[model samples]
Structures are given as C-alpha cells and as structure tokens.
Target: MIDVTMTRAYEMMVILYALSIVLYFIDYFYKQAKIRRTAFWIVSIVWVMQTVFFLLYIMEMKRFPVLTLIEGVYFYAWLLITISIILHCIARVDLPVFFINILGFIFVTIHLFAPDQVQNPLGESAVSEMLIIHISFAILSYATFTLTFVFSVLYLILYKILKKKKFSKLWSRLPSLQQISMWINSSILIGNPLFFISILLGLEWAFMTLEGLSVIDAKIIGSFIIFVIYLIILVLHRKGKLSGLNYSWANIYTFLLVVINFFLGSKLSNFHLWY
Candidate 1:
C-alpha cells in the first residue's frame, strides 16, 4: 500500500510539473500575469513534493540521495526547480526560467522512468514523450525562423515598393522597413537558442535511447549545419556586416535550407523514420 501510494504521488507530481511547463510557455508568449502566478504556484507545489520525496528517501536509505545515478538525477531536477523559482521570483527573467524548467522537466522524467527506480510499465512511453519534446522544440524553432523569413520577405517587398515610388493603400498598411528588420532580428534571437537547445536534447536522447545511431546521420548533420548558419548570420548582423537587403535575403535563403533539411534530411536519415 505504501508503494502504491508513493507511485501515485510520483505520477501526480509529474503531471503537475508538465502542466506548469506548459503554463510557463504560455506566460512567456502571452505575458499574462495570471498564468504566470498560477504556474509559479504549481511549480512551488512540485518543489514541495520533491522535497518530501527527497526527505523520505534520505530517511529510508539513511544517507543523502546523491550516491546513485537515479538519485542524482532527482536531486539535479530539484536543484533546477529551486533555481527556477528564485529566478522567477527575484530575477523575474522569463526566458531563463522557462528554459531551466525545461531542463528540470527532462531530468524529472529521467528519474521517473529509470529502470532502477521502479518497475514502470510506462518506460517505453516515457522515451516516446522525450522524443516528442525534442521534436516539439525543433518545430517551434523552425516556426519562429519561418516567421523571420516572412518578415524578411515583407521587408524586401516594402523596400522595393518605396524604391519604385509606388504609393498605395498597401504601402500605408505595411510596416516600415525598420520595424520589419527589428522583427527579423527578434525572431532569430529567439529561434537560434531554441534550435541549439533542441539539438543538444536530440543528441542526448539519440545517444542514450537509440541503438547504433550515427552522429553522421543526414538529419543530424543537416541540423548542425542549419544551427551554424544561423549562428554565423547572427554574428554578422551583430557586427553590422549583414543588414538591410543582404540580411533579409540571408534569412530567406536560410529558411529554404531549413525546409529542405526538415523534409529531405529526415527522409535520408536511417534512424529518423518517424516524422
């Protein structure tokens, strides 16, 4: 009965953790104070539950719970949650808190489904959940880059129309070139880090979960190439060497590469059979 209760509590904690992550993501995008407060409360509850479990483990084993791989993972997750709460409350930084909680969620999931922790029938499902998260991050980054591309295209169009002195209702409705350029930069700033994080998570998952997965897989290579290109573009823009038309065109071309990599590279990869 004790074991069953513990398992159910663990499951509930995981669910709340996931829900808090989703809420944080929404708060990040929407900037809703209510959502942020709710997420904070939920995360606080998760932290309390984690603390309870940590104490229980220490009492049961008569030692700190950091000696083994599973215990260390749980402790690491707890630390992440603790730091995230500090950042959320004191620092009030949205992005760092969100990303830290993402890492915390990953570690928490790792602890929950680790074979040594318990005989969990959902072990395979946990692996699938990780895969889904990896893919979701990649897709979110890609979508952000696509937004950058659209803004770049609009910039070009507006630039051309102004250059040709074509004054119309569309000219009044379209955002200025500077505004579009700012959007382009903002999108890349957000998307690039997300892409980098996704790549790290993908490689970690592939190495730990999949057998005989190659680092040279087409999808992996393509992802790295895309990441590098964006990094370079960002650097160039920061140095003021790439801007205006060149910057816009660079984003457009990079997005085309992203499209190809996402489809063709996936098809070519041996282990990336799942779309």
Candidate 2:
C-alpha cells in the first residue's frame, strides 16, 4: 500500500510539473502576467512535493540521497526546481527559468522511471529506463523543432503576402515577421541542444548495455547526420549566410530530414524497438 501511494503521488507530481511547463511555455510566448503567476504557483507546488520526497528518502535511507546515480539525478532535479523558483521570484529572468525547468523535468522523468539500483550485471531494467529517457528527450526536441517549422512556414507566407501587398485579416492575426523569426530562432536554440543531449545519452546507454553494437546502426548514423545538419544550419544563420526566406526554407528542408530519419531510421535499426 505504501508503494502504491508513493507511485500515485509521483504520478500526480509529474502531471502538475507537465502542466506547469505548458503554462510557462504559454507565458513565455504571450507574456501574460496571470498565466505566469499561475505557472509560478504550480511550480511552487511541485517544489514542495519534491522536497517532501527528498526528505522522505533521507529518512528512509538514513543519509543524503546523492551517493548513487539515481539519487544524484533526483537531487539535481530538486536543486533545479529550487533555483528556478528563486529566480522566478527574485531575479525575474524568464528564459533561464524556463530552460532550467526543462532540464529539471528531464531529470525528474529519468529519476521516476529509473530503477533504484541495478540488481544484476546486465542491468536490463536500468538500461530500458535509460532508453525511455533518451526517447523522451528526443520527442521533446522533435516537438520543439516542429514548432520551429510551423513558425518558419508562417513567416514565409507572411513575407510573400506583404511583398505582394495582399492585405487581409490574416496579416493582422499573425505575428510580425520579426517576432516570427525570433520564435524560429528561439525554438532552434532550445531544440538543437535537446537533440544533442538525447543523442549523447542514447549513445552512452547503447555502449554500456548493448554488446556488439555497431556504430553504423541506421538510427545512430541518421541521428548524427541530422544533428550535424542542424548545427551547420545554426552556424550559417549566425554567420548571416542564411536569413529570411532562405533561412525558413532551410528549416523546412531540415525538418523533412528529421521526419524521414524518425521513421525510416527507426524501421531500419536492429535494436531500436520503440516506435
């Protein structure tokens, strides 16, 4: 019964954390004070729950829960949440807080899913949990990139419409070209790092767990290719070699590669079972 209760509480905490992230995302883009306040309250609740869990673990273990990898991840996540709340209240640095929470959320998810200890030499369960973390990070990055693609498409449409002097209600409804471009840049800024981290974690897990795994596996190669392309795209944009319609088109094309790699690479991978 205690185990069941703890599991349920963790689930509730995760739900609230996810909701807070959504609220933060909205507040980030819309700059709505009420939404930001609500997100702050929700994050506060999550922090309290995390504190309760942290204390409980300490009491149960009779020590600080930071000696092992799993314990360290939980502690790191709690630290992130604590700092994010403090920053939200005092520093008023919005972007850093949001990104900190994102990192916290990833670690929290990993802690929730990972086994407390590896019981055997193989550690199959622990390896599987790491795979889940890898997939979670990858999907989150993909979602961010999808948002970037959408904004880029909108920017293109707006650019064409304005260039042709076709004024309509749509022009009023959409954000200005500069704002859309900023959103595109912000999404890429966040998404690229996330994808890179996912790739690193996935590679580490594979090396540790999978015997005789080849580096030329379809998914591995495809993911690396995609990462390199995005890095190049970001560098080009920074160097002013890619901008305006060309930048938007570059994003669109790269997203197509992401989609293809996601589907085709998964299908071709020998051990990439999750779909």
| lDDT of predicted model 1 | 0.79
lDDT of 1 by residue, 1-275 (tens): 99889979998999999999999888766778899999999999999999999899878865454434466567768877886898678747565567678878998999888866432222443355455456556756865686677678778888898999996753454567887788789889998898988888888877887778789889999999999999999999999999999999999999999989977997898766333
List where candidate 2 sits over 4 angstroms from the true fold: 1-129
Top model number, TM-score: 2
Instruction: List clash counts for every candidate, in order.
Output: 0, 0
Question: Model 1 — which ten-residue stretch has the worst lDDT?
Answer: 117-126
| Per-residue accuracy of model 2 over 64-166 as CA lDDT, tens digit each | 5543557656776876788679767865756556767887899899988987652222333544656656756776687677667767887888899999999
Name the regions of candidate 1 deviating beyond 4 angstroms: 1-128
lDDT of each: 0.79, 0.79
TM-scores, one per candidate: 0.55, 0.56
Q: When superposed on Cα atoms, how far off is each prediction in RMSD?
A: 11.2, 8.1
